[model samples]
Target: MMNNGADLEQCKRLIETSLGWGDAATWTNEDFDTLSDRIFEKTSVRLSISTLKRIWGKVRYDSSPTTATLNALARYAGFEGWRDFMATTQPPAKPSPAHEAPPAPQKSPTRRFITPLIIITITFAVLISFISARIIHPPAANLPLRFDHRATSDELPNSVVFDYDATPMHPKTVMIQQAWDPKRREKVDPYGKQHTSIYYYPGYFRSKLIVDGELKMQSDVFIPTKGWKAIIIGDPLPIYLSAAETTLDSGRLSINAATLQAKTGSPVFNSKWTGFFDVHQFAGISGDHFLLRTTVRNTSTVEQCLCRNVSITVMGKLSAIIFPLTDRGCISDIGLYTGFTGVSGKDHDLSAFGCDFSQWQQIVCAQKDQTLDMWLNGRLIYTKPGNRSIGDIVGIRIGFEGTGEIKEATLQGGGVPQDLLKQP
Candidate 1:
């Protein structure tokens, strides 16, 4: 195929086939958008929705797509680049009917092909009916699923491979959920033996192996003891901070507004704001029995309709306790998950969790057996039963949605509350 006319047409055909478009004329904007998203997920580079539309001939105008865009699509399709894809997958050769001659019959048509044709039709019908029957009456009761997973390494940017047996049930609907994020959910063939995924950050993660929307098996993955890492989310990218950039004053790891602005080149009052602090010395902790004590204060003003919000996450191997703090009137969207059923601000009204966040306030989270309690300034504010292990505590993460200050923090395995009135 030449680059001028037929080559571009061939590229369009390849994209359409890769996207499973039955008919090119019926391709919708949403379909192109899905293609763009899939491409970005597989490769880090994102192609604009408009660029995809033009490539698919959904919109008018175009010089050839830039080399970068072509390379991205090629990488998305598992090739080295646009040139590589073209070199490996050549366009189909067209037939020249004008140069062909009529064939002479060697035998009677009915005698040679009629009997075989009838047999082939019957076999096809039987296969379709068998498939239809399976669809109509799907698997009942859970499949005898055996699931296991292990990581290639127990460090940052680790890859974990999950091995499972769910082939006895519906093979098409088997999926592996890597984390709480919907984007982490991946569909796998039930008949397939294994699936692998990589963890970009360190924490306790509960991975689920699901069959037909039902959880067949669940496991906890803990990436342990990587020291404290701090990050500030810069939308699609994250700005990482070194230990030198942060200070330890008293007992608190200090990250003030000035530090954030200098590192990110932007103020903390922007629409999208995030500051993360993680420590990885919690190998012996569990969500079922642990104590966390901290006092946080936000120096930024709450005058701009946004409260000084700070979140503390005690991450366990299979679950986490998240507390989002804001002003007395703002809402809290905290969560605790053990196999998809735990506490979340969406289901629990957290208006009661709000307080004066501008001043330093004592915060405590503790769990004893199946009971979990939260206390603010020695006053028990929230209590919830049905406490289950989210997983073994691998670490803790403290995040700020705006400019905030950490006065002091401590974690104890268990027992009576540490006296906040007594300075260490």
Candidate 2:
């Protein structure tokens, strides 16, 4: 990916510029795809995702860029940035000692010894005082408190604007907040459904939701005398069919198939369809796994009738900490091959394939009264607990496993209405 030194510099600059806009942790492979392709299209050398990561590493360490790298970097930015960066980062080389006249150097051994002794005595006195202090005044009942404040890369003044990407998991709307500046805010999918915040701290960056005066999702900081921490309240629960309001902070909602997105008051995140996955019925640890059923109304001019059962692939994750995110395909880019799928081994291999994450998540589809379990090929794999919890889900998908489709469809969930599932 690093060809000419200049090309490398240009790529690095572009990446830094882009990272300046959003959360670096939330970066997607698609972003790299776009950046690399654009660089190649404009210039000749190409950069890969791995290459981009390496450049970021350099920036983290305050390293200098070579001449060739700088020139290429200049291509991606305004003249001012590239020019200023080059001038500021590069330093003038020092002349070799050999090129200058040699000077006679002498030092007094007695003076050196006296100075060293004086400094050593002072250091010893300070150490003695510290030890005495410790002995006389021990720590309180609780240990001394320490707080880890991570810094984020968000700029000084925060900004917000419309997101016009046709992608699936991005915010239809946005909420920009900066500690220093007045929020530069705008709403795009005021009708589409959610907002996102790229929160910048001094050390780490978090792309989360800001309290829309409307969604009032707020949390309290319960820092004790021992330590300090703030719980995130303006946050949605983990992605579950049972996602409910932790409190009355209006913005809490599942970012799945059933909820209507009011962009103006959209929470913090939404589905950015990077690709698709199957959601179906199956048997499980909880019981009849997921109830897979959907009623497809003829929205198209022709007869809108599906024929096969929707295939649901469940990936296993130990922790759902990074469970729901904007970067969808980053976790399973290649083959999704674990957990449970389709049906197990009764009549047919009703089974589809599955993938697993370090975190845990259950994918199910069902209604209030009815239940649906997993079937791979035709074999029953798992049956889930409860009913179809996917909020107001109307449309179910099946293309995640190569080229699959939901054949039979019916919407009978006790959640929200079925018609709300259409793409806005």
Candidate 3:
């Protein structure tokens, strides 16, 4: 759970990244509605539109979000939970005093004399009160809090049960957090012995039991994947596309535009392409040692627009590599989270991909022992060392903001590099 003002600010940034919005002020009511739908689609948890607006500062609310809300948002952003996101991701650097302007020039003579005299009088009064308080009472002991949790089954959609003990010296509130999302939270009897919750998705989840506003007990829960699944984030509702629906095109797996329109009854712009590769199909091997190569291009010939934006995600058990390609100057709008580095958004320069996107572009991203390296058109584009562990290779997803085509794509596990870009 977040413990300070800085934590709240960081949480807001995490939410913005997850929703693909660069800033809080940029979020609209429609955006919040879409977020509400997306969260339910991905996590099976419902965060009300009003609550989301309040959390994102879109609406005036007197109170901050509950711990449950934070956990849910964190999980949506590819963290074990909110606590994991905060503990692992580094917050933005604070502005240094050296970089700030110096204090204003000294005040006039009469103002200066009066300010010093007032300061001296306050200091004398504070000193006298401090000595009197010390003589009257002694220092107090720290508050005591205890919590422990367990799951009914170490599987997907498992139920987690918690047991906790907290000593409240004063009148304080007590609640249990199932995940970082507020909807997953509930107020429990302060003296109660246990509480339970159900988790629908597979990932590393950090659970917390809170007393008052502070987190008292915490633990992690891991749910393994069963197999590969395809999801189409379409308008009106999301459809679960099946492997049987995909066609093999010159050694690549893709869904045709006519098939997409037939299935969704909508245009390609209303659809979001997402596919997950089950570990079981690849000999059930899971780890950070994996490589993904895919070629994509916009095939839409609509007279109104020629450029189509695309993004590919290498989904690991605990993290993901988001590679976004679009017309020059549009990459900054993409949100990517690497387990090692913190979340990257509009503030980060992603101009490496700002170029013509109509033609097929080859992208290769590899991860060996948590160190991720990427190449575009056989040219090394970026590399970064990871600070955290890459839990497992859950799958990968290819998507287009409007409409696009996939030429070829493959996932390799613990294998020698291949000349993927060789002409077909």
Per-model C-alpha lDDT, please? Answer: 0.69, 0.32, 0.63
Question: What CA RMSD would candidate 3 show?
Answer: 15.9
**Tens digit of lDDT per residue, candidate 1, span 124-191?**
99999989977775564544667889999965567998988887664677889886554678998778
- Residue 314 error, candidate 1, Å: 2.3
Pairs with backbone N, CA or C atoms under 3 Å apart (clashes), candidate 1: 317-391, 317-392, 318-390, 318-391, 319-390, 319-391
Error of 2 at 24 (Å): 22
Residue 153 in model 2: lDDT: 27
Candidate 2 residues 1-424, lDDT tens each?
Answer: 2334564455555556654747555565445545554454333346554455555552253445554444444544433345665565558677798887567566589887998999999999999999996776554333321111222323322222212222222224433222212232334342343343443111112122232211112111111111111112123321211224111134311122123123213332222111122222212312222234321111111111112111232221110000111012232322222222112223333223232222222333432343334332233344333322322222223221111112243323232234323314
TM-score for all models, in order of appearance: 0.55, 0.24, 0.49
Model 3 score (lDDT): 0.63
Q: Is candidate 1 or candidate 2 better by TM-score?
A: 1
Q: Give the TM-score of candidate 3.
A: 0.49
Q: Write the per-residue lDDT of candidate 3 for residues 1-424, one digit (tens) a residue.
A: 5445577677667667655777668765656766885566445578888798887667788776787787777776767677788778866677798798678997999998999999999999999999986666433245455677777885444777777666433326677766545455678877676777666554455566666554556665555555544455644345665667654545445555666667666664433454433332244434467777888875544432334566787656555567777667556665555553433446677777654665678888777765677777877666766534455665566776545567777787752256733524
Candidate 1 — worst ten consecutive residues by lDDT sum?
333-342
